[model samples]
Target: MINKMEAKHLDFYYKDTQALFNINLPVEKNAVTALIGPSGCGKSTFLRTLNRMNDVIEKTKVVGEVLMDNKNIYDPDVDPVELRKKVGMVFQQPNPFPISIFDNIAYGPRIHGIKNKQKLQELVESSLKSAALWDEVKDRLHDSALGLSGGQQQRLVIARVLAVEPEMILMDEPASALDPISTSKLEELVRELKNNYTIVIVTHNMQQAARISDYTSFFLNGKLIEYDQTNIIFTAPREKQTEDYITGRFG
Candidate 1:
């Protein structure tokens, strides 16, 4: 498998408290890799490290390398903004701009300097379609995005990410807030999205991980315990900790 990104001996700290330890993992291209663990296992911390999202938090430090396309993204010269553009993020909650749906998706591209009206419209249409939201909102393009359902808002946030043309997408428990039906729809969307975007998702839901991810990494107490094929990790993990966690023996 072609690895789109890799974390080598990665460690992170919030002030003096260490949050992650010696994480080494490969994110394969055009596939979904899920990070699974209980709360405070550092899954989200490690996810943020991928695009330097942790940089926004004061007194936080990262040690080791996160390589993208074989180059260490943590290198001094690499711009976090540029890295973030290549690796877009979606949070646990959907956060759509309160503006019109058309403008929300257009926001990123416009920031990146695409100014023509027709081109913006095309991007808006295509991005919404890619996110599986165009059919629902195509006629209501000028309507306020905040009026959308939670599921629609989440998908709209995804469309916003797509508008920027990211190579990789990071998701932090994206389905946790949705209803079962909406969660299923999001899962289906995730399955479809893997054909084009390399996705790394942090999910507390083991079932969700099994359903959507090609690879699964089990983290505990801020350390990586096992990383393997999803089926194997679910059925025959190499480590007892992984097996225990998967079987609900302990988190």
Candidate 2:
């Protein structure tokens, strides 16, 4: 399988405290890879490292490499802003920009120099459709995003990310705050999206990981305990720690 992203011996530190240790993995293209672990096990921290989201923290440092398309993203010549545009992120919470639903989806294209009104409309429509949110909000394009339900807002945030046309999407506990029905919708979206975009999702819900991910990586205490096909990871995990965690022995 072709890899869309990779991390090699990656270690992350926040000032004097370290978070991730010597991580190495390949993120396959057009597939979903799930990261699972207890809170603060470095799952989210490792996710942030992919697009240099950790760079915003003061006195933080990354050691080793994170490569995209075989090019090291951590190279001194790389521009984080441009890199992020190609590797969009969906946060744990739906954070729409307190604007009209249409404008929220159009924001990325407009920022990237797409000035034509017709073009913006087309992009917004396509993006919203891609995010599975078009039908509900198509007529209310001018409506404030905050007026929508939590689930719609989350999908809008996803549509906003899709508007940028990124090759990969990183989600950090994306459905954690949604109702069961909404979470189901988001999972369906994630499964469908993997057909065209590489995806890495950090999720606490084991069932969610099993249902949507092609591969699963188990992390513990800032270290990778196991990585394998989802079926094997959940059914016959090789590591004792992984098995224990998956079998309700311990976190």
Candidate 3:
């Protein structure tokens, strides 16, 4: 499998404090890769670097190479806005737009200059269907998105991301805020979506990581401790820190 994204000697700092250290990993194309570690271990920081999301934070400095599809994302010529369009993100919380569900999914295409009603409708329908939310919300496309349940809202967010037709999807604890059933549904959606889009998820739930990820990276104290196949990382990690964390002995 070809690598969809790669990090080389990644280091991040916020003012005087360093958050990541010499991190290196490869994200496979059309696969689910999970970043698992204790809180504040820089997993989310690393995920944000993929699409330069950290650029918005004040006093944040990044020194490393984040390569997506053979192009260095941090290069001076790289357009952050275009990068973001190619690499979409889904936050931990389900933050649906305060508008009609159809409009929420149509927003991205509209921004990209697609204004035809039929085309927008097709994009909305396909995106929602891809995110496994079409049947539930098809009749209510014009309903307020805020009225949906948490899980539905989350799926709506996923559909919105999909409508943009991103090549890669970054999920920062996509299901962490949801209940078990919702989480399960999200996991199923991730599994289904991986056949088309490369997925990188930052999650603290080891069980969820083990359940859904094809690859897993373990981080500790702003450093990458181990990265390998998910099953091997869970069953018999080469690093003691990884073993301890996965076995629940320690973070």
The collision pairs in model 2 are none
lDDT for each candidate structure: 0.95, 0.95, 0.95
TM-scores, one per candidate? 0.99, 0.99, 0.99
Give the local distance difference test score of model 2.
Answer: 0.95
44-133, model 2: which lDDT tens digit per residue? Answer: 999999999999988999999999999999998999999999999999889999889999998998999999999899999999999999
lDDT of 3 by residue, 76-170 (tens): 99999989999999998999999999999999999999999999999999999999999999999999999999999999999999999999999
Worst 10 residues of 3 by lDDT: 242-251
Q: How close is candidate 2 to the true structure, as a TM-score?
A: 0.99
Q: Cα lDDT for residue 154, model 2? A: 93
